[model samples]
Target chain A: MQGKTGSESWQEVWDKSVNGPRALIDCWQEIPCDPCQEACAQGSIVLSSGICAPPALHAETCNGCGKCVAICPGMAIFLVDRSIGSGLARVTVPYEMRDEIRLGGEAWAVDGEGNYLAEGRITRVSGAGRPGRTMLLTIEVPEEWALKVRGVRGRRKLLEEPEEVEAIEAVEDFAFCRCEEIDYSRLREIITQGEFRSLPALRRFSRAGLGYCQGRFCQSILRSQFLADCPEEDREVESFRVRAPVRPVKLSRLGGEDG
Target chain B: MSLPCEQLDLLVIGAGPAGLCAAYEAAAVGCRVTIVDENDKAGGQLSKQIHRFFGSSHHGAGKRGIEIAEELFGDCLKLGVDVRLSSSVLGLFSNGEVMIDAPTQLCLVNPGAVIVATGASEKSLAFPGWTLPGVMGAGAAQTLINIHRILPGSRVLMVGSGNVGLIVSYQLLQAGAEVVGVVDTAGSISGYQVHAGRVRREGIPVYLGHRLLSARGSTGLEEVLVEAIEDGTVKRFEADVLCLAVGMSPLCDLAAMRDCRMVYEDALGGLVPWHGADMRTSQSPVYIAGDASGVEEASVAMEEGRIAGISAAEDLGSLNSGEAAERRAAIAKRLDELRAGPHSRGKLAAKERLYAR
Candidate 1:
């Protein structure tokens, strides 16, 4: 119940537990799926009798065969080393989605809940498309944070070169203010410029909040980019403007069918 | 046991949206068609989904999903498609043969082509008191309210913010029940904004980043507990009905037991049989359509069934290949509209494994 997400399970991290090259193939769900069990060449995984039984990994007999990792559809399984030979344990989890990232870039690793913590380095990549094409991302970290580092941050070029302001080419439809036509493309231009490097600076240039919709759609979308463009002295962390009518509609006029 | 076989032009398993569509299309092409389903009624998921569907004109946009299913089933009947209800397909034999358990007899049917449209299975979530009697899937709740006109409970706590959870929350309100709120461990609502907004406007606070840590009840569900994902803080919310809308997975046991080509695609919901544009799987003549191939809305599932049916008819030489192509084009065109919108993107993403080529 509280132990797993869809098909991923929860295992408490033990600090004093002996560091081994072994890892438990964790599953959070019992989703009528058998790729992990079927994918296991070493006969490592077994499912209960029910159609939606969560798979239990036979830790004592598992041979570290990468077959199950390649075939798990949920990308929930991972390989971990409690401690590498040099005491720098490397944890490998699957990483997906496109990012402008490269090797050797410093990354802030996060846990299952996505809270950012200690930094790590990319160490290895496994099966691209053997059965499911899940990439085994090997990340090196402190032994204490080995079990906690489930994912890594992408796009560190900004941290590397603070003064650089690269031009953005492709654009999707996003308005700075729902009531106004302030396009995101224009907002980016104004915020990236030297004249408006901070939130207050960009606010002055765009008049983004100067609309009837208050600043619901526009403010938060601009917050991160605005903070990134601004100098360290002007960065103030704020959440997205959570507004009502949170959906688009004439609240006073309710135009949809009653049904 | 070695089962007997009866050869035919097309045989469809699960006479729901997919099977009905496939049977109607195949029969229209002058092919002998047979549709088998386990439920007492012919329409699989359709009989239960009382909500309106979204899509273009072809896919019955704005029409209740169940209505479209009825129309397809009617067309199947008009086309003289032999439909057998309460017929559970036991196993898939080698080639296109199938073993079925019908009332009073264990029958067999073998067609040149077959379509599997088993649809999806509701997921179960576990909490400290999850085994309580008041807990159920959102679909089960919908069935109780819409089909039987019975309120699940006086006050309920919905777990998961996916479309099912959100939609069911609103439906519960319509049925005169109090929905305290929805809790999801994920930070953002997993469903469409419209569905979430409707529930939100009703003052049902959707607690993103909250998990149902535990549930406590004596004989039935009386209280539930939620925990903040951020700080691990726990809070109690009194709930009589605890509905799980965590997610669903494609029911591919029938396909898998037959060794049909299958794969895992999050876009489609879960594990499903791999099929071609015509719905033919690795077993050359065997075809599958609807949710059995992958988890998708009824509109896409029907169109996929039709396309498979037409393709099978053409292959069986029951209709001109040119006629089959025309029907496929029209159905394919309709499927495109259903799968083109923002909502269909997930299904599109799920089928990316197929659409990539």
Candidate 2:
């Protein structure tokens, strides 16, 4: 998770080695998507729990068709062939950034953390597909760093100097309501005062939702904070009362006077 | 203070993709169409989207949104659709009467048919310091970059991993801004993998399961504190601007005023007017399309606009029932294809529930 050598478990799977071409479904979470399975024309990609499950690839059945590589919405699918050559291996990943890496151009392979890993050359660049707006790029990397190199920086490096985390106190003192100019500390102070019991009382005490835009923006914030402070079992969340003239309107304009 | 009212065959509110398409379709069918939008320009949010759209070629899949908007606007103009820019519909009366505030005068319009395509408004998330001057909506940032040709800030922090957040983060990078990272509370990235891949490859770190706790600054945004939900670890990242792409809610104020049955569907972005297959609301002569009916893609909105427009034209006797049915079927088929993805299952169910009655 720290760097982008895919995930640690994926890295271990890649390190264990395999023969020929294989599709790596780097997706771990059970998201409501299964385009990768549908993209596999060979029936190699399978999911157990309908479309909401992550795809499971059958390495033997996957012929490295690269269809799943092009169709994956998460761009989590990758094709790796360690048996390409003695020292050189091929890795196909989706590239959709603005700066396109032309075929045969020098590709700067980077890890998951955007750190430069090794240099590679773009071997192939595929055209855009249907739903997924990504183009496939096959890069030739060293056999050892094939799995570690997850992406290629098409343009410049976005490496930033590591900054030390300063010990900051009272950092949560910020504005909660943009319309009413209410800060978090102020709202917290009001909450701790214990005078306001209901949302309307809170509104009256702090003027959190009395701005021109009404409570359309701040009411949710007030509710969330109230819930966070008070246990749900102890208090029921109350919504702000809505009135006529829901949206802001000029008095003169309401009078039908032409400007 | 009663003003003289103009009569129209069909009145379209908003000039976005939906409203523009609705106006064009109705006007092409010989219905006297008038489109009213609050903005000075006609292309609503479409003008701000510089990225190419996704879907079939019929929906302008390969073309940029700005180009698509231009094409729609050109069609509306060529078909002689009356466009009222910088005109806001102040109130929508039940009797097909709309009170509008134009630049010059306050006027009223009584139309035989009404189509609401007012679109959606950005939903904000509350964190400490979210109200700071530098913090703004991702749509606002996109507008500033693509439309206004201005960068909101040099170092930006995007909250949300949905398509909007991912796309806007990429756009921010394209506009020469340093995206600190994209943070989302969801365990997995909510947006398309292509968009996420694009931003990830650009070296923008995406922190999943991380919720924005607070934004710390005095006069403006200085830094943002995001806490990982799983471990409760807080990390502060340096960011001048905080872009909230949390979500969007349907702008159903006018629709509600018209007494259209509204439902709070979380999948459809909360508080959307109940509309049917032809985009017609419960109220006769009143139709809803686009995000005003429910938050959806621009492609779906365009199709819904065409369907609503054809329905309105048929109601006005400009288009025959046979022609309207054919057009609606074709558009509905295309719409079904667009919503046939796994990600759109929720939206599909939401649409079903909306039209169940």
lDDT of 1 by residue, B196-298 (tens): 6446534577888987766668999887777777876666777899999866666666666667655656567555677767677777677778877777767
| True-vs-predicted CA distance for residue B228, candidate 2, Å | 1.9
Q: What is the DockQ of each candidate?
A: 0.01, 0.17
Q: What is the interface RMSD of each candidate, in Å?
A: 26.1, 5.4
Q: Backbone clashes in each candidate structure, one number apiece?
A: 7, 6
TM-scores of all models? 0.56, 0.75
The share of true interface contacts that also appear in candidate 1 amounts to 0.00
Residue A198, candidate 1: Cα error in Å is 52
Off by over 4 Å in 1: A1-259, B1-4, B355-357
Which tens-of-lDDT digit does each residue in B1-357 have in candidate 2? 777788878999999999999998899889999999988888888888767565555767545678788899999999999898988888788777888878876778898989999999888876657667788999999999988899999999999999999999989998888998999989898987757866876788898998787777889889888777887767888889899998887887787888877776778887777888999888888999999888888988999999999999999998899999999999998788778767788999999987997
| Candidate 2 residue pairs in clash (backbone atoms < 3 Å) | A4-A112, A4-A113, A73-B193, A74-B193, A174-B129, A175-B129
B162 in model 1: Cα distance from truth in Å? 1.8
Q: How far out, in Å, is residue A211 in model 2?
A: 2.2
